[model samples]
Target chain A: MQLAHHSRAGGSVLVWTMLVMVILSLLAVEVLRAVSGRFQVGVQAATWQEALLGAESGVDLAVVELRKSLYPAPNGAWQDWTTVPGNGVLSHGLTTVPNAGLAGSPMNIEVNVDAPAQLKDPATGWQYYRIRTLGSLPLSGPPRVSYNKEDNRLRKLTLLNQRFIDGLFTSETNDAHAARRIEAIIRPLGSFDQAIMSVGVLDLNNQNIVIDSYDSRDPLKSTNALYPYNDRNADGTLKRQENGNIATNGSILDAGGAHVYGDVSTNSGTATGVANVTGEQRTDFYQDPIPIGAPTWTSINPAPSTVTNNTTLTASATKGAASSRYVLRAIDLSGPQTLTLAGNANGSQTYIEIYVTGDISLTGNAQLTVAPGVSATIYFKGDVDIAGNGLVNTNNQPGDLLFYGIQPDTGQNPYVKLGGNGAITAAVYAPGHDVTVNGGGSDGHVFGSAVGKTVTMTGVTNLHYDEALSSGGLINNYKIVSWFEDTR
Target chain B: MKLQLKKSGGFALSEVMVSTAVFSAVSMGLLMGFTSLERNFTATADFATNHADEMRISDYLALDLRRALSVQAAQNDTTILIPAYYDNAGNPQTPALDGRGGVVYGAIGSSVRVRYYLSGSTIYRQQDSAAPITVAMNVKDFVFNVTDLGKVVTTRITFNPTFMAGGASAAATAATAFYNTTLLRNSRTDIASSVY
Candidate 1:
């Protein structure tokens, strides 16, 4: 009985052991499957990320192309990018990552742009345009239709057309993860016609401030409406216009006795000094603010300057005298300084663009000059402090002497200050900050138009709006206003 | 002669009890191991899924915000409204502008009046009056902190993943946050003055 019992117990033990082994094996399999699934998910996540980055890169390339196509000529001729191929598509070569991750895959970029359409306001002649960009991963093999010999010719052709369009938006996988679509609306930054435009509050403290207009583009015009309000042009010529003055988005507080010779418009805030404004003073005229984009430093000749903090740039200094384009980090010119353009014999004007990365001080006699048909532009990334007889005199047209200021939100208020006895002849676009003309007891004047956060006149300063600036050829760059991604 | 042959058929009662007890203990241990492993595995999978969803949501918002002419966050930072246009093949669609220069989106575009919001635990995206799409799921919170820097706008998104797995509360769950500062690609004067 004992022997039989021992044998039976041994058999039962073996059976139980086998069952345990089987259970362990099944558990192991489940663990392996779970691990494999997790790895696959990780892989998919990485691919989706790559796809998104690829799409963004495609957009960046398109923007570069747009910049190249739209930059105006040296003679101030507009090269509208929207005119390219009318409703056609432009393709950038495929980009592939040649590493183990996402091996042998290429991302293609197709940019399609529609023709420009006129805005509702016909007088401005501003055209609005739209651009669409498709970023996709292309299929690795030829069409499946080609493998079937019995396919009809029409069917093959139809398949080819479908594949072609699909290639622009669809990826190799039917899954939408491999593709992205973005669309943008674009418009140009036209000329600034008003003598002064303030997006913020404007306080006029001077009584003798005279604002007027003249058409510099038309040489046959009657009398000069330039500075001194004396009916004499900057070149001693006679020209005049009854319209063109100040406009503001905020309130215009004219302390008693201030006078504006032309129209005054405030889109938002109240214009309190009714007695100060002469010609048609209209309130609540909604005006669109000018938009600005960061300037591309690519292809700019002469390396960026290494000048550091609080450095002075005199006419005699090495940095300021260079006739070539100079990118200054930060500069100060408190005394008399004249920037002259060289090599001007064949009417091939001197071309120079100065970019200031920090604060700029133009106190006392600060002047900028270019011979006939020559042009110069000053781009400021920070504040511009002009005070105490500081003058930016340019012989070229107001449009030729351009001042483009991009405000930096570094706690300091970015602005173009016109202190007492200071003056400038340039089209100013500091769309991000304020432009102040103050304390210029009798001689402060701004020849061109100002488009910025605010325009405040607290002195006997005058604004001379050049009617010729209304022409569309003055090239201000375009910026994206609205961007949307196609979720589908 | 009497002690010659006695046949015992099976195991003694105590021996049987010991074997059964041993088998039960081993089986329970195996089950426990598997259960622990599965819990960890499930947690990992849920985390990954949540991460991917966060990324997708962030990508969509970033892309749209980067090119947005105007971005307005409303309803206590729970909703965002954007007015934009995109070119569909050769057709150009844009949002209608209100008399106050605000975008009255939905004039004629995919989403002239696009809005993103959070309701309960799901993030939803809608265009005009169109039905909302689930932007992300398994979400505990969706919030936007928008800051306007003159020409450029920056937005921060906070996404939290809850610990609900298989209809049961998970012991561990972490929230994901994303910060993006998109310079307005399109220049729209109205964008600067828009109030959210």
Candidate 2:
């Protein structure tokens, strides 16, 4: 009986131990399968992320291509952007960097400018482009596909698996297994297109101030009573409506008599005893104060090799039409100063840009002249003072000569004081300080815009706004208005 | 009666039965654990796939709506009108003005006219009569609601998706909803229109 009982207990222990071992083994197998599945999925997720990065790389390349299109030669010669074939799509393939344990994928990009979706400026006829880009990475092929297709029956068995894999990566019908689309609206910065733009109080205290516009491109185009400022057609007929629009962030106080030929927009203040305003006197027009920041000064042609600091020129200084730029730290014209910019006789227009750091004082009949078809712009980083009959003389259109006051000198209370007895026909954009036009006896007839903080017209000054300047004759940088991703 | 019956040689009937019962109970517990793990895995995988699909569709809709000029939704489909212009190099062709001084914006460009709707279990996007692109599949339900707030337009999207896990026998589902408000960039209010 003892032998039988011992045998029974041993048999029971063996059966229980076998059962427990079998269960544990099966559980371990299941756990291994789950872990393997998770590893595979994780690898796929990493590939997806890498593909996205590749797509973004394509966008970066597109931005560079766009900049090239805007200024093709890089020497400031204008080129037609719309002339590029296939809407500016470049045939290029990008392979990502294989560094830091990452074997990047090969990406392809295609760019399309939605011409019909472009935005056009009504007054200037300048169009903004909407660029669409498609970035893609090819799909990975299944392993041992040839073996699976060796037999027709086996191929049939693998069809469903192949379909599943394709569905996982494919987007639309394109060859790109992983792909993304991006649409961006790029608009040029028309920051200085208006006739007058100011950031301070404006005062029109002159009685004989006449503000109007005329097209200087044509010598015969003039402002008259019946035509106002409209351009005449070839048959001497009015083409369309033209007006010289003026605006001020501050007040426009006409203390005495004044005649404004175009619309007068003031953010604040009242017009007192104004003789005539052709356009609407909009009091509700509000404009934010323009900030006076340092100039970007990007790739200005004929870049100065060295900066001119604290230089006073009393004799005549001549500059060639080709590659002429003056980057000065400080400049003063003492007496009888004449600066001349010669024309390029090869029918190529000459362009000149001047940058000043400190105060620019023009005293005792200082003059600046340029030939026809020559464009010149002076950028001042400090106060500008024209004390005695200083003039900027140019026979070209009013848009040819531009005075841009970008920054204010410290403690100088940077102001534009035009206290002379000569007419200056140029556009002045000073949004940091007040402008004082103190002259009389047919002296202060400004052909272009006079934008200042507080424009106190204490003399007989007339401001004329050229409608042609509002056209696409000015240069503006491209800006991205909106950017987003499309994952369709 | 000197016969000491050699103690019963094997286990008693009750002892055998009890051992068998305990073994059966432990096996059953292990089987239940495996089933629980599979169910949880299926649920997690389903949620991940659904979330990814929702994100893709959401991004596409937001970009389109923000650039659209006007949007109108109906029971069957939603139509979006996008104003388009062509740039002729630096010299853009002047837009024609009507008698009322309104700019006569002509036909929209290719791929600009978009319509989104649901057919069967798939969401289809039709662009200028192109082959309908399947934006999303296995969609159990979808809804689009548009609200116009003067200059701003808001669009609400809802998606309920169901996908097959393991095989046709095992089906998993996820539901999500979101609202995206877009301020129409180009309102089509130009100087000519306002003046007229």
Best by DockQ: 1
Candidate 2 lands at a TM-score of: 0.45
- Candidates, DockQ: 0.14, 0.09
Regions more than 4 Å wrong, model 1:
A1-45, A69-101, A117-129, A138-177, A189-443, A449-473, B1-28, B56-77, B84-111, B115-123, B136-196
Residue by residue across B1-196, what tens digits does model 1's lDDT show? 4344333446778999999999999999988987877777776656666565555566556655654555675531333445534344424354433322123234533235557777787767676687976776656545655676645666666544534444432223213555666655544445423211
lDDT of 1 at A70: 48
For residues B11-113, write the lDDT of model 2, one tens digit per residue: 7889999999998899889789768777766655555444544543554455466556556656437766543432333222223322221233343221256
Candidate 2 at A125: error in angstroms?
A: 10
lDDT, candidate 1, equals 0.55
Candidate 1 has an fnat equal to: 0.29
Backbone clash count for every predicted candidate, in the order shown: 21, 5
For model 2, residues A28-133, the per-residue Cα lDDT tens digits are 8866665555443333334444544554554455445544544314422213332342323323333334431124445545454543323555544555555555
